[model samples]
Target: MTYTQTTPDHDAGTPGDVGDVVRLLEPDGSRLADAELDPWIADLSPHELRALHRDMVLTRRLDAEGVALQRQGQLALWAPCRGQEAVQIGTAHALAPGDFVFPSYREHGVLLARGARPEGFMLAWRGEEHSGYDHTTINAAPPQIIIGAQTLHATGWAMGAQRDGSDDVAVAYFGDGATSQGDVNEAMVFASTFRAPVVFVCSNNQWAISEPVTVQTKYPLAGRAPGFGIPSLRIDGNDVLACVAAMRWALDRARRGDGPAFLEAVTYRMGPHTTSDDPTRYRTDDEVERWARRDPIARFEAYLCAEGVLDDSALAEVAAAADALAAEVRAACIGATTRAPETVFDHVYAESHAPLAQQRAEYVEYLAGFAAEEAR
Candidate 1:
């Protein structure tokens, strides 16, 4: 079956076309109507809308705490998800419990929505663990550090699900920079050819480290997927309602065995690429200020308030909840202790091998020398 484009031809693209983005809520907090996308989120009640706002608020607080911790030398590094809260929270909310997610290192909002503990979220960044949480427990893999590698992993898992005759879909979340990686292209090739049940979400935050996205591709990022035979949508990543609708639409297609779908969420990264880099060196304050006005949480909050779904009291409650969670995260991160150095050798082999046993013994002995020297 041929994949049908969900967006208009004018919006989908030509070589020079900058695709018209799909949006439900304007940057100014006004709502727009889309016949094709509206029904996907029509069932969302006022309570659910309020909940989305709360999730974004909490996610931002978590991001803030992460940045502060890294600055204070608690976390080794942190990828701030400052301006992309809507894409993460909205897509995450659309996901079913059984759907698996393979996320890049910046998707803290996704991890939080997946019910991952805040303490667990900090483990890897704290340099205390290889993986923050068990993939089997949450149906989501640990945040992948290698750019675009998770796309291949998600495609492989989607193929596995197809072979097992299961309708379960695998979703891969990556940044715009990952699209330039060969692994992402190869994964798309396999996914399209095999008609694997997968959704590829590209959060185009307009920057890949010190480089701007304009240098990454001349055409819209969404246009690249169609060449691989996957239908794609480009949406306003800052608009939570648009995100929810677009993700639900893609998820439905995958569940129906229609094959893989791609979504490009156009957003801006309002902070540095990571705690280790200085964004000011690459981007001008004027540009940053322009994007700041389009902040995802503020936009969503405005919409909620306009709709009478949220009031000053409700906003205060959300703020209190966010503050409490931020405090919990800070305390947990600060109090976390590193594991015994020797334990690193424990999981190398499931069953101990003779060589591994010998190595472990030598390592333990090596550590003992430090203890002896300290005693002296």
Candidate 2:
């Protein structure tokens, strides 16, 4: 089914089809010639293509390690991106250095792609910090834990960038469930009205926790954007090339002052919602197995192999690099130092706020009194 219920005003695509699921790679690992998308990816050398593959591999490894850490009690929670690596990596690579990204909590691949240090990247999952990296350095905001709030943040940031006369754009990364949120809808309205240079990327991974996408909307998520006077596209999220091409197109439009755009990436979540969730409770093994056959990494590996871009040695090197990354993340997570209870007050403000200062002092005195009583 297309993204939404059709009216005579339905301007998205043909009614019965899947609403223009853009693709440049077939499931069998063959690349198709597309005039529109080819130019966007033409500059990528063979070495660069291999590096993209490595990025996907390493990102997946990082996610796997995070899940394992959570299971082993090193982390309070972990979000898996097992089956959506291609979409995250592809779109992240399309971003310019000056561009800003506002991401949902599950965007581990985006974090790694944007150059977040593996050690710091897991700090929030380990319950150690409010954010893992400096937003100024990465040009990416910390992952937003509150549903669709980041969309509003991105729109506001983009408005500021526009007023500053900069070519920089902002992107909001959210999930399928987030599109149903009133905050996201309101953000779209503001973005459209103000013509903000923002891109809204919805990774429709079939399921939002236990609820299916159908429960969220009767039509494609992309269909929601046109109502706000923004252009939108629905693409095959499993195809990395399609993601890169689509993102480039959308970013170009935003940078050219054509206002905002929306992208709906059709993918699947192979793992549970988080380490705390159980997929078997809601989904069937057969369905998961079907998506497994369409694995993005496997298809990309096959394409690279077919193109003579990867040999056994190269493949071995990529695997080794992924393993090394996982090791680094694990060591960082295990060796991370826990802060004292009082330390939580350290970074709450840039300059000391009187009220917080008083509260911190009072709490410290209370702790000291308890220690003195225990000594007696």
Candidate 3:
């Protein structure tokens, strides 16, 4: 699963013909001038820049805690977002309060940015609840477990918003693997045909579990959108500033009824796909080490420090906040109570149903038989 960077072919009509990836912040903390993107983030203040850095630090801390909890048997599983914090935090920060989000299972950073409580995030992983937060409250859907499904949900929601004549945009976050799914293509089709006000964000993390991106496609993922008549951008996912600018561009277009846009955030997965996965078997330590050098948090920290937006005290404050959040999440996950098994049937229907009631009764009786045998 070692990734080798290939030069994109600029041949017209070819998939690799998509323009260069949009990058505003270099890996070494230098700024790359982009006239089109500069205006998008030009109004950001020093405080806002510090906040972005803090968000990345907090996200990485949360991810670390999640991995530890799963390894310690506190959670069923955890999908690590170690190297993709910029993609999540930056895009989420660009969202308006009225905008809706549809996310894949690994979007904890997005949920956090959308104001979801840390405790609520642990509920689903602990098997104590079906969803972590109220979708209506945050204008985001529950994390979709099925690969590529959230894209369809986002498209449908966007269509609904268009019908209601609302300017709010719908954003869907998915992994590179999901782009290969039929649901994703179908979503693009419907979105393009109707000019749906949606943004499709593909976090191209270079691997789909054990498979490398090369196995999926030889061309850039962003190029696929053009075939559906959707404009797209390829962005450097490790640069938070670029992510924010790119997302703002896409969101603006969607809000203006310019139809759906696709974004391919080129990033790498520095950790295992999930706590249950073993990266050592499928990827090299060298590859992981190389990506670590481009660590999103570290890069952003460097940039902020250079700009005098953050000093030692500011860094320490952010670290302390992250530590506090991680502790809170850990305690909540460990202390969460397991629900009754019968409760699975509780939300199966909106209201009472005759057949469902009978089935529930039979299940109850079956459980009672075990108790009767134990008593005897």
Candidate 4:
């Protein structure tokens, strides 16, 4: 299961070690023989495969539109997940509706997979809302931007689920960079200690901002979980079938009250960290070009086509669906409106607090002063 690269820069060690990475699809668009992982997706029919492809395409389309909106100054920032669609969409689709998902800011694909509205999803990026949607409605949390803090949130939720004697699992999605944060480690400790029904999914997209993953840890990111008494899986994030199988396996473990599971989805972020980043200052074109060849959507499409599940009309239909989604999301983002400044004070506390109340009054008075002065 060794993969050969034309470039010498592509190392053949742990990163490319097929033994450690669960891959069901090769970069060449052929199915890799993975007997252990095959049964997880064996029940998938041709229609289901087509649906997965559609989901990936639409996720990419939404992500592309988000980037464009950022570039056009409609959004304050956009975290592009261009090359990681398979990991997000595939994993997300494996979840039960009652399960909860905590995602980092870049999980546009996951949010879409969970059936969150495009307009609502755009609201956060547009700087119009603190969160994109009502989290409870989707059984998910708003995108967490505070590094690895969401891990703690997911862990806490899982603990509560454990106490309630429910089967729902909580999943936390973060990047390789977040692994360096103390909050992530603490969350892992709590998750393992309580035997919480949680899954920590680390999307190891090589670089965290400007630093490579090697800078964060000497060992494989998945290797860190075992020390906490949690089992881990290192999987090819670009392979849709692999992602789906891995997530199902992890979720099954969590539902069985087997403590926590850690999954490192090894993929690459094709675009900048966000619209504000300039990747050119650090990474090379050759590296980007190499990863592009393993694009998840392209690989999945090839697999479907080869399997006789996808044809010219099917491809056309998916493309049209993506185009329609992009258009709808674009319109929604453009039409999104901001709330009044006073509304910010509304959700600051569950009960009336004197200090916040005083500040709200002062803020109103301060705004009124401008109106009074304008009368002059």
Point to the candidate with the largest lDDT. Answer: 1
Sliding window of 10 residues with minimal summed lDDT for model 4: 1-10
Q: Where does candidate 3 stray beyond 4 Å?
A: 1-19
lDDT per residue (tens digit) for residues 264-300 in model 2: 8888889999898999999999989988887889988
lDDT of 1: 0.89
User: What clash count does candidate 3 reach?
Assistant: 0
Among all windows of ten consecutive residues in candidate 1, which has the lowest summed lDDT?
10-19
What C-alpha lDDT, on a 0 to 100 scale, does residue 52 get in candidate 1?
88
In candidate 1, stretches whose alpha carbon ends up further than 4 angstroms from where it belongs are 1-19, 348-350, 365-376
Question: What lDDT tens digits, residue by residue, belong to model 3 across residues 162-211?
Answer: 99999999999999999899999999999999999999999999889998
Output candidate 4 Cα RMSD. 4.3
Residue 109 in model 4: lDDT: 88
Tens digits of per-residue lDDT, candidate 4, 1-376, equal 1221222222324542334688999988898877767877888888888888999999889988988998898898999999999999989989999999999998988988898988867888888887868888998899998999999999999999999999999999999999999999999999989999999999999999999887776667777787787788789999999999888888998998788888888999999998899999999999999899989999998988998999999999999999999888988889877777766787657786999999989988998899899999
Q: Regarding TM-score, does 3 or 4 come out ahead?
A: 3
RMSD, one per candidate, in order: 2.9, 2.7, 3.9, 4.3
Instruction: State the TM-score for model 1.
Output: 0.93
Q: Name the 10 consecutive residues with the lowest summed lDDT in model 2.
A: 1-10
lDDT of 1 by residue, 1-376 (tens): 1124532344444322223688888888999999978999999999889888988989999999999999999999999999999999999999999899999999999989998888877988998887778778889998999999999999999999999998899999999999999999999999999999999999999989988788878767887888888998888899999999999999999999999999989898998999999999999999889889888888888888888999999999999999999989998898998899887776556698999988889999999999999999
Off by over 4 Å in 4: 1-20, 350-355, 370-376
